[model samples]
Target: MTLFTGLAAVAHAQGMSVSSSAFADNALLPAIHAGAGDCGGTNTSPPLEWKNLPQATRSVVIKMTDPDGAKGGGVVHWIAYNIPASVLSLPAGAGDKSGDQITVGKNVSGAAAYRGACPPVGDTPHHYVITVTATDLDPGRLPPGLDAAGLAVALAGHTLNGSTIVARYGR
Candidate 1:
């Protein structure tokens, strides 16, 4: 099986799945969800939904990364964690600076908000991988303002199950 299929199987076995209303898996991201700068879009975060989390889950973490960004060194567009397990979805714009309920972590740009997809002009469309992880940690276990790397370090050994969706965007 493909690596993605293998991972999906694992997640399915753990009873979790994630999806977005703004785009299908492996589909092009809408311009409304692109960055507002040179990318020329509205910079709105897409709506996301997840379900069937593991019974032991106490919190959730969401991360979006552009594997092709920054000279092939991956860039984190968003990191949100410490979300109550009872929350099954995030509405559009929920990644904004003023978002509530969930703790917003810093993105690659150091902003505790979503930085929508913005690939370099003329490059092939870049893939944005968004993952939602269910963890056993309490909703308030993690502090705010942690960046992607820091979040990763904090999440070690805590993830119980997770799911991922891939969207493409380009200038």
Candidate 2:
């Protein structure tokens, strides 16, 4: 198996799972999580669930990125951090600012909110890698409004382990 496949197998064996109620693993994300505008979606955050996090975990950071966005690396769709370890799941539309359980960090769109897929029309479906990282960073200590790149830099030594669930979306 390839390294990714092997790692996925290992993660599965470890019982660390990140899942979504709106769709199955590797399935297409629902329209609620789709990007607004020409894509025509409500742009709500999909509900997410996780289990068997590492013992050292103190917080969590949930993010989503489109791997086939025709960009060099990928296009970040969401970056939400400061999630308490006690919280194992997020309800649909939880990314909204009001009554949100965690801090929704800045995304590629410069909005600190979930902005779903808006891939170019006629392009192949893009794989959106939704990752849930368990980390040791204290929410209070983290600077406010950190973007994906900034949070990634801060999570270097703090990350314990993570789970990834892939979903697809296209225009």
Candidate 3:
């Protein structure tokens, strides 16, 4: 086999898997997880689960973004990092910023809490991409007030392998 193919196999074996019991990948999000911009849905974060991480992973980062927002630059829905490797899942509304196990970085709204999906009224369904990265960094490596871009830099070269789940929503 080609070296690239072998590497892909090994990486897949070591990669973590991310999923949500709330909705399937590419599925529409339920109202409880949606924004309340006349959409009338609660602004709660969705539940997420992960598994199959490499043993060397020290922490995990969960970032959710809307590429369809921010006039093409992409809007950050959430930027939670420093999640202990022992944590395999986050319950709904965990992003409400009530725990110390993980650090919630600043999102587009300039708040550390999760900003649920709220596409412009009558706009096409926007895709929310939730990514979970297994990394070798310590729990407090990321400083406060760091947005998703800065968070990406902090996670650079430290991420082992990760997974993503994409869900669609629009008003």
Candidate 4:
């Protein structure tokens, strides 16, 4: 089975769901969520909330990725983990370099903060999947500064449930 299929199954069984107040699933993201440099917009992370997490969850991890980026290999826009399970939501701009109850991870650019979508100019809109994972690990179980691959390896079989919301963005 595919990785996404597995995550969907877990989400379904656990009744977990994630949503964004800034944009609905499969909707276009606002310009404020775009990258600041060439993308020409404020780099702000959207507000996100999760509900019905599994009982085994001790912490939550959030990741945002653009599957069509980097010539189709994918790009990691944000990776923040070590969020206490008691925390159910992240306010807008929470993925910034510093935040409460969250430990930022390295994105594609090696920055330990959110790097908003910046798809190539003139390309079709890219689909950005933002996933929230409920895990059995403690809030401080993993060290900070982990990249996407490192975070995945650490999460491994510890993920109890997960949910995703997709947003579209273009240059």
- Reference-based lDDT, each prediction: 0.89, 0.82, 0.85, 0.92
Highest TM-score: give the candidate number.
4
lDDT of 2: 0.82
Q: Which lDDT tens digits does candidate 3 get at residues 1-171? A: 699998987776676689999999999988788775676577788999998888788888898999989777799988888888888999998875636888888879898888888888888999999999989987777777678779877877999888999999977
TM-scores for all candidates: the values are 0.90, 0.87, 0.88, 0.91
Model 4 TM-score (2 dp): 0.91
Q: Which structure is stronger by TM-score: 1 or 2?
A: 1
Point out where model 3 deviates above 4 Å.
Answer: 1-12
lDDT of 3 at 72: 75
Local error of candidate 4 at residue 56 (angstroms): 1.0
Residue-wise lDDT of candidate 2 within 111-152, one digit each (tens)?
A: 878887888887777898999998887655576688888987
Candidate 4 lDDT score at position 75: 97
State the lDDT of candidate 1 residue by residue for 92-131, as single tens digits. 9886663456888898889888888999999999999999
Q: Give the C-alpha miss distance for residue 168 in model 4, angstroms.
A: 0.4
lDDT of 4 by residue, 29-84 (tens): 98899899889668899899999998788999999999999999999999999999
| Model 1 residue 91 CA deviation in Å | 0.9
Candidate 4 overall lDDT versus native: 0.92
Model 1 clash tally, residue pairs:
0
Ranking by TM-score: 4, 1, 3, 2
User: Which ten residues in a row are the worst by lDDT in model 3?
Assistant: 34-43
